[model samples]
Target: MFFLSLVVLDPLVVVLVGLVRREGIGLAGAVMALDLCGNWWGNWHWLRDDPSQLLRLLPLTLFGVFVVASTLPLHRVVARTTARSETALPSA
Candidate 1:
């Protein structure tokens, strides 16, 4: 629950951690997609039983919001921080 909200507040953490620990931001998003699907499966009782539109859309909406937030701002940061030397493949 808290983790879901934090993504809204700041998705940069997810992007950075994904880039640093995994291969890139895409993997991080894939992980989040898995989590989203898991949430739908795990919480189907409440989600299906809920009457409010907000409640129904909450979890599903979060993934798209987080993905956009994580990618848009970080695109600038990555462009600024990375150089050709850093992104280039090393000659072996």
Candidate 2:
């Protein structure tokens, strides 16, 4: 049940807000870490039993890593763009 909340929170709270704000990227990265931990914890038993099942979950793991790895670069780009836009705005 708690894992389900993490799943919902990741997209709705992180992804949607991140689309509108650069800080969202950092939030998304944090949420992704939590999600990865939750998934690993939830699947530990099955993974321990079969081992090969890790293959099936590999893509999810990779994606989480990608999100975490890219967050800083992506956030910097967004922040730079926003700063440029704000500065470019003429005084009203």
Candidate 3:
């Protein structure tokens, strides 16, 4: 059920990214983090049997690494943007 939901949720996040909303970016980071953990958990047996299998999944692993590396910087940018926009609005 969880994996099945990701099928729809993943694409929805892509669309959310298109909107460039802070929530979307946050969600994307979260989804990708979950995805990486799920993939590793599912593949652990094969990876244990043949450590070389890591080579086959290196791209995915690298992408996961990149997402992990970039998420913090991206989050800060979104936060700053949100803060700026909020401050720009006139007081009620």
Best by TM-score: 2
lDDT of 3 by residue, 1-92 (tens): 66898999899888987876777777888888888888888889999999998886788878988976787788789789889989999999
lDDT of 2 by residue, 12-90 (tens): 6565554768768877888889888888998999999999999978999999999999989988888899899999999
- In candidate 1 the C-alpha lDDT for residue 21 amounts to 33
Cα misplacement distance, residue 86 of candidate 2 (Å): 0.6
| Tens-place lDDT digits, model 1, residues 1-92 | 74566565346645666565323454456556666666667777775677464576586668666974586465656665666546685877
For each candidate, what is the lDDT? 0.60, 0.84, 0.84
Between prediction 1 and prediction 2, the one with superior lDDT is: 2
Per-residue lDDT of 7 in model 2: 62
Ordered list by lDDT, greatest first: 2, 3, 1
TM-score of each: 0.45, 0.84, 0.81
* Clashing residue pairs for model 2: none
Clashes of each: 0, 0, 0
Question: Model 3, stretches more than 4 Å misplaced?
Answer: 86-92
